[model samples]
Target: MTTKSIPDILRQSLESHMAEADLRDDDELKELLGKLNTLSGKVAAAKAQVMARRSDKKR
Candidate 1:
């Protein structure tokens, strides 16, 4: 069986639904993901901090 590659439209949709994530092409997507991967921990930490602040303000 052969596997099909992901389409650009699907990638665009996914990125739009993500954290304002976007890319111009497959190569750009690859590069963007690589950079994001390296900053994943920081991203998660920042998200958690923002969430915590929101929760604290709500209560």
Candidate 2:
């Protein structure tokens, strides 16, 4: 069996959320996209930290 990492799981969930929000009206979609963007940035930052830590461990 194969296991997916936390970051991969989070990325998938974020993509799904964004896809669903895309079907809404313009105003509502804009608001949702803004929030999703903020969340995605934060998640990317956190994922970077995790990757850095993993690299450090390998050194």
Candidate 3:
């Protein structure tokens, strides 16, 4: 299987549903929101790691 980022997965899922004229239930939306929260944390962690590496290289 190919690896896809969380945002890409989310976008593709939503786009497919949109094309099919399907409605999302509250529970399904909630799960997507949870995924978004997880993505946010991952982004923050990556930013911190990059900053730390840059700081180290500057020293």
Candidate 4:
């Protein structure tokens, strides 16, 4: 089984909402997606830092 990251799950949920939404606005959707992408990058960076710290402690 494959694990899905938090951001991926959130993005999927947001896209699903957009698909089912009647009041679709292009600019709003784009902005939301941009924010999600930024958050995803931050999460990735944090995870990497945590992993690096763990590796250092193991040495």
- Per-model TM values vs. the true structure: 0.39, 0.54, 0.58, 0.74
**Candidate 4 lDDT, 1-59, residue by residue in tens:** 44666887888888888788943758988888888889988988888898899999999
The candidate that achieves the highest lDDT relative to the unseen native structure: 4
Residue pairs clashing in model 4 are none
Candidate 3 lDDT over residue span 1-59, tens digit each: 43566765775787678668685656877688678768867876787798899999999
lDDT of 2 by residue, 33-57 (tens): 5676677677778778988999999
Winner by lDDT between candidate 3 and candidate 1: 3
- Deviation from native of the Cα of residue 56 in model 2, angstroms: 0.9
Measured over all alpha carbons after superposition, the RMSD of each candidate to the real structure, in angstroms, is 12.1, 5.5, 5.2, 2.5
lDDT, candidates in the order shown: 0.59, 0.67, 0.73, 0.82
State the lDDT at 22 in candidate 4: 43
TM-score of 4: 0.74
Worst 10-residue lDDT window, candidate 1: 1-10
**TM-score ranking from best candidate downward:** 4, 3, 2, 1
Which regions of candidate 1 deviate over 4 angstroms? 1-35
Tens-digit per-residue lDDT, 1-59, candidate 1: 43322343444455775645443446767676656555654656676798899999999
